[model samples]
Target: MAQSIAIVSPAVTIDNTLGALFVGFTVACCVYGILLSQIYTYLTHYPMDRSIYKLIVLLILTLETVDQALIGQIYYHYGISNFSNPLTLIEGAQTWSFILQQTLGSVVGAIVKIAFALRVWRFSQRNFWITGLIMILTLGGLSLALVFTIKSFMLPDVFSVVKLRVLGTISLGVGVLTDIITASSLCYFLNKLRTGYRQSDSLVSTLIKYAINTGALTSVVSITTVILYNIMPNNLIFIGVFFILSKLYAISFMATLNTRRVVRGKGTDRQNTTANHTNIFHLGTRVPSMGPSDMAGWETAYTATSATQQEFDQQRPIIPLNTTGFQDPTLGKRPAM
Candidate 1:
């Protein structure tokens, strides 16, 4: 009994230490996500952003709160009081902590995925076909997530559940696929939307960068979790990555939201140019027929408007010229002097 207890306890301790380390990392990331969300809220006013956008962000933040709480509870159970007990390793899989984590995380994933799909829809100018297809893929992933959560509760233990394979594999696989599609679609359209100008194209490029970072981060995280689950089915190493996926997505969305002001600021600077109604065209890798700086000079020279034209006329002095047939009075009167 002493030998068995010694071997088992050490192994359990190792697992718990890793579990704590991962959950600690997850908590730190959650704090960062919340901070990002708050920054987004502060910058975007209610009227400036539609009610739906605000509400979705609210939902994601709320879910993140609950998810973080669940992880904390499980972390306490494994790391603090039960690290030395091997029996407690699988104990978490059957608890409410596990269930809520699965459910809430899945819901948050769906929310963010749909939000991105809506963005795609808007970018496409309400094109039903494109939006519909993306939404379909997102919904499919969400459905699989729902099934995985439901089945998790029905299962006996983490070991038994993971052995089923199809449930966990499909849910995560579909999620990765959805993220790839969403990110790629955004990049493709954002590239198309680039105006080849400094300001707007810079904004679009920023958006593409965000899309790539978030999408790749989540996709790689998901794949890692899936691989760990497959290889170390009995170990809870994958739990750490699995737990943070939703928060990553939420933070990504908030980061995207926060940058809207930056994009709008760049775009707002352009309103003056548009309102002026000048015709300096910009093209990719091609010189304009008239440069923007030159356009102002051209406009002053041939502006049909009375206001800008009159100002130029007043700025010039009326110089008197001497002709060959007639001399100026001031020059002719010099002889009498």
Candidate 2:
């Protein structure tokens, strides 16, 4: 009896680990999804392109939140007690959410990659090499998304051990490739900006740096998931990693937004200073008395103008012209012949 109990302990330990990871992932998803939603709301006041990208990210966040919640509940039921009766429902919900999450995640990833590529393309209009490189990266991202979505759904029983391992492996490869393409494209744009030293290069360089960093972080999570899945074929620690990846992605986006705001604030400050100086110069020219001189100078100028008027009146000679050839006795008039 003791040996039998000992043999069952490992299975119990695995189930508990899976349960804890699922719960942790669920909570992270909830927090990250809310963050993404807030970002979407903030971007809605921006242009349509920016709003659309935020909306796509928001949708992905929502899907991930639901996926994690459902999986976490399923694992909770499976691990917490002898509630085997709800196994069918748990399985169905888990499968459905997993499928939706994978599909939406792929789509969102592709969309963001394309959006960044388009931004780079816009900036590098005269550089065909950079533009072509961005296009290729966009194409690769889209292809990876398409392949992953189709492959994930091709097998209905995705929760099975074989399907999980196979799908996870394929996703790992695709994710790595996608990361490489994105990172390389962003680095190329950064290099181009550095070489050209264009006026608007700093903003582009910052954005590229953020994208590369976020892509690399996501790739690490994907690689970690792949390794963990391979080592512990039935464990669910991968879910915790997924949660961490989701939160990190959201935080990176928030950081990007904050960076943009700081850059915009600096630009606005410079513009305001220029406009203020222009206004002051125009005002000073119109009202010379309001120039940056002392009040004593203004008073002195007023006194000098008054004295000049008096002198002008005093210096003017009193001359009179008579219509007739003779002047009257009582009148002091000069006659012109």
Candidate 3:
């Protein structure tokens, strides 16, 4: 007797698999558009930015573009080209693009984290302890991510990829740690920079808020991705969240850079208004009565004061407040004779 083979249609589980991917891809594209605008704003408005900074922005833009293209290929392979093949969709075959995207995502995450680490280092006055810890965690996460990608590539299907859950979890967990540390360090250092002037402190507070917001956003998304990956290793639900992870990193980094303009503008405005009412040479300093023979000493003191003010301004990363003209409120009104 000849046996008849029955055809099994694609399961509804695709809602969490392909459906999740489609939604994530859509959101990622939207974020990518925002990133493009940010890049344009950064380039057009801040042409004087350091070359290294420009290179970093360009590099992230290129990587994100390639990542999106690879994601498109994955969609095409599974959703379009293989539309008729229910078995492939159900099996969750990991294509080359899928694997490459995971690896590239790790690279983008590491780059962003390390860039933040550099910022922390600068804000912390090159504190090796804090910066070193962040760098180590970032590198560790990247290493684990690479390992996970390699193992996933070696596996035949998404189901097999589940076997590396511990590895993936650890990698993402490290990323979470890095994000928290980097943000906390930034806030701590920035708070220390508060000079007690209302405008200056407000700027510092804004910076701290930005650090918390960016770090929290990236960390939350990472946590969600890892949880989804572990809970449903067989579905592409986790991969869907992973799809937008790199884009978020890029957006956060660019947004932070672009904010410098807002800060600079506000600081300049505060500086100009304060300048109109205050003596440009007497701010944050007191002058001693000098004799004609002491003219050389006065000149030396003025030069030294200018150098110190310049150094202090340089220490501040986001808002370079020229403290020369801004009066510190703590110093009460000069006594009238």
Pick by TM-score: which candidate is best? 3
Better of 1 and 3 by TM-score: 3
Candidate 2 residue 290 Cα shift, in angstroms, is 40
Provide the TM-score for each candidate, comma-separated: 0.71, 0.57, 0.77
C-alpha lDDT of candidate 3 relative to the true structure: 0.74
Question: Considering every candidate listed, which one attains the maximal lDDT?
Answer: 3
Question: Candidate 2 at 307: error in angstroms?
Answer: 56
Candidate 1 residue-wise lDDT, 223-279, digit = tens: 998897788665566776777788778777776666544444544232224332233
Shift of residue 225 alpha carbon in model 3, Å: 0.7
lDDT of each: 0.65, 0.50, 0.74
Model 2, range 219-244, lDDT digits (tens) per residue?
A: 78878867876776544566456555
lDDT of 3 by residue, 91-158 (tens): 55678898899888889999999988888876676889999999999999999988887788788765
- Arrange candidates, best lDDT first: 3, 1, 2
**Clash totals, every prediction:** 0, 0, 0
Which residue ranges in model 3 land beyond 4 Å of their true spot? 1-12, 268-337
